[model samples]
Target: AVANVCGFIASTLHRGIGLIHFPTTLLAQCDASISHKQAVNAPHGKNLVGSYYAPIRIIVDTDVLQTLEDWLLPDGMGEIVKHALCQDVDLLTYLEEYDGALNDPVFLDYIVRRTIELKCEVIDIDPKENKEAVVLIYGHTLGHPIESISHRMGTACCLSHGQAVAIGCVIAARVAFLMGLAEESIIERTEQICAKYDLPYLIPADQSVDRIMSKLPFNKTWTKEGTMMALIERPGKVFNFDGHFKCPVDDATIRRAVEQTMAPFGTIIKGSGSSGALRKNKLSNGDLASSTITTPIGSPMEKPGEGWAVSAGGSCPKGDC
Candidate 1:
């Protein structure tokens, strides 16, 4: 948080160059690298304080990802899946056909480049995340809450941001299906892709449905009138119910979607126990203990000044940089 704030301040003060080295795939493909956004988490919500600050240039080193543990690979795939669903059908096909070769540097480079390009296109259209750019947040409406709550409960290692977004994709697909916007195949494909990457599609048994639902209002995507979510009708196509790209989704629909998404994994009985399919291959406590969180470096902003400042090396004061 301090690094990003420092970077944001430096960019505002001078013409800075932001060099981001993505150790995890998620940081490479998602908000950390390409977008003109900087933010820090607050007590109320994630990314509660932020501003639009695009970088002069972004450098993605695929070799850096080679050092990531196997479990960490899915974090990047979550964003890849999001891009494929919203903008690139070919990318979706690639994921389905080459699920086994996900770790290959060549394949990883291609995915990262393509994902970055897709994001760049969106940023060009809506640099401030106001209109068309909102589509980029296809699965994040629910994904953010799951991530926030998981981190708060100290289960973030068990449920990483990428994993939560993967689950969010499934839930969004289900919601689209329920609204008669998306075909049944889309939902199946969404779940299949998540499973292919060993990412979570169902909400965990421990998370509270009510709590997740309550966080909807606080989402950054919401407007003054109502909650706006980016729902999809098919791969590479976003659903636009009323001509506005950001569609308004009701609480009842979101609740139903959450319930149905959780139903397949298990039935949440009152206060006692869940009955149904037991969670298989759950992450061991040791694995969770060893898990680490990586925050993306903020992009630099173009301000008139003399020199450039880079925030690299040394420990972050907040211990979360």
Candidate 2:
């Protein structure tokens, strides 16, 4: 889908036409939003038609999520899970433990800000995929098939993109373990976290491996060698390539593994019973997390390592970092 869009935009520009990308899916915000990748499906595989064309501007407005289906939330979460798997334990913990707080403005603000910071960091490090910045695809090699199948089948009984990706994460984790890139614990942790958010760890039932494989060649990441799957070994460490195993299984193994990791719920994290009590104990301001780690309510810029770290070891004040 992304590759095709890019091709259309590029081809049109060559012939004197204009193209604009407005991504409503959750995956769009995290990965697809970063660059120009358009794709379309064909008999051989998923994205058969595509090209790269940078957009004039990429706009992300949280308000758009308001009208989206509840299932779509997890679709976006695939990207979030990928980001968390890469650089932020805080994010993983938050999603696994305090995801209920997401409804709170304060919590959402922190998440939004953190996401922006992470994206900026990645773009800064590698505006072009000339380096390891490509690690962003940690769970995507498997994820693309899930999404392609879901999209190809349409919305009726198919998994949404985010759900497919969530399941893909599980598949990647298992693959990681098989290749010795990641430990069993990480796979369990990934599954546990997804469960906390009500995301399915297993692939959708009845999904055919051959069906998904049929779409693989068209994927943007596909190469002359074969499909490449990115597996997470540890936070910030990703391993990618095509044929790493001595005894690689067929598509059936892939389908079965995906199913084994499926979760019963969808993706929105549920509030624990204490959620009401926490809301009831609201502070005067919206700095709930910050309020927990304070020191003497000290004056602004008190000293180094203090709430307000001022130079010269003098109190600078509290308002600043």
Candidate 3:
């Protein structure tokens, strides 16, 4: 499906025809739109063939969502979850208050407005993802690995992109908490939002932990080191602490965290077992410990002049950089 869609777009570009994407599926709307456009496909995974080209325009008509299925609504909700966590806390509150009634004209309008505004804000600052725009990938780094490996295992429908990302955000937050960049409350808050929307909160224990971790090194934004974890400073901001944490944390810690977050709901993989499913592997029962992450060399500490200084002191609402 994706290849055909991309082939059509590529053909049009070759013929000098401008491309405009009007994604209707919740999966297409959030995940496919960006993944198809930005991330290129690698030999090991999907979406390896692509370029960064801005669409002439994106029209996310809420009315179109009226015919969506129950599952599709949550798929789109995952994007809302991402936007809320990284960019707008108000949107999180709104979703928490209203139980995903995207069919409502007023609610759909609100989501479309906020989603567009958030994307535009990201573009205005760094459309090309050159500088701090890395914040837009808050949940994607770890999430993609999960999706890729799942597909590799022949369980393509196992998890959606947003579901993988919804799980990844909590994992990233847990890493951030370990680094002291965020508090436990923040992690809990993230969980609360995910739970409200029924997003996947953990990975299946039977998943190939090794294969999933392998995908980390392929990140274009990653440094030479395999370590890549985004540090959450505040809303509308994320520090891509590439090479900050250890490459693969101990199996014990990974299992504990993955299982703990997932216990509330059923096992990470719900429904019937697939034909090519692997045997169940268990996470070791032991203490999971992570120390504080330090600043990389040449990347100076947060002194007066470090990072992008938008303005000095009380200039911006969130306080000056």
Candidate with top TM-score is: 1
**Global CA lDDT of candidate 3, please?**
0.55
Predicted candidate 2 versus true structure: per-residue lDDT over 61-92, tens digit per residue:
65565566555555567667767876676787
Supply the global lDDT for candidate 2: 0.54
Model 1 agreement with the true structure over 10-80: per-residue lDDT tens digits: 45665555534333444544546666776776765667776677666555678878887776677668888
> What's the lDDT for all of these models?
0.66, 0.54, 0.55
Q: By the lDDT metric, which is better: model 1 or model 3? A: 1
Give the range where candidate 3 is weakest over 10 consecutive residues by summed lDDT: 288-297
Say which prediction, candidate 1 or candidate 3, comes out ahead on TM-score.
Answer: 1
Q: For candidate 3, what's the RMSD?
A: 16.0
Residue 221, candidate 3: how far off, in angstroms? 2.2
Clashing pairs in 1: none
- Residue pairs clashing, model 3: 40-47, 40-48, 41-47, 41-48, 41-49, 42-48
TM-score of each: 0.76, 0.64, 0.70
Deviating ranges (above 4 Å) for candidate 3: 1-8, 11-16, 30-43, 99-102, 154-157, 240-268, 271-321
At residue 315, candidate 1 shows an lDDT of 23
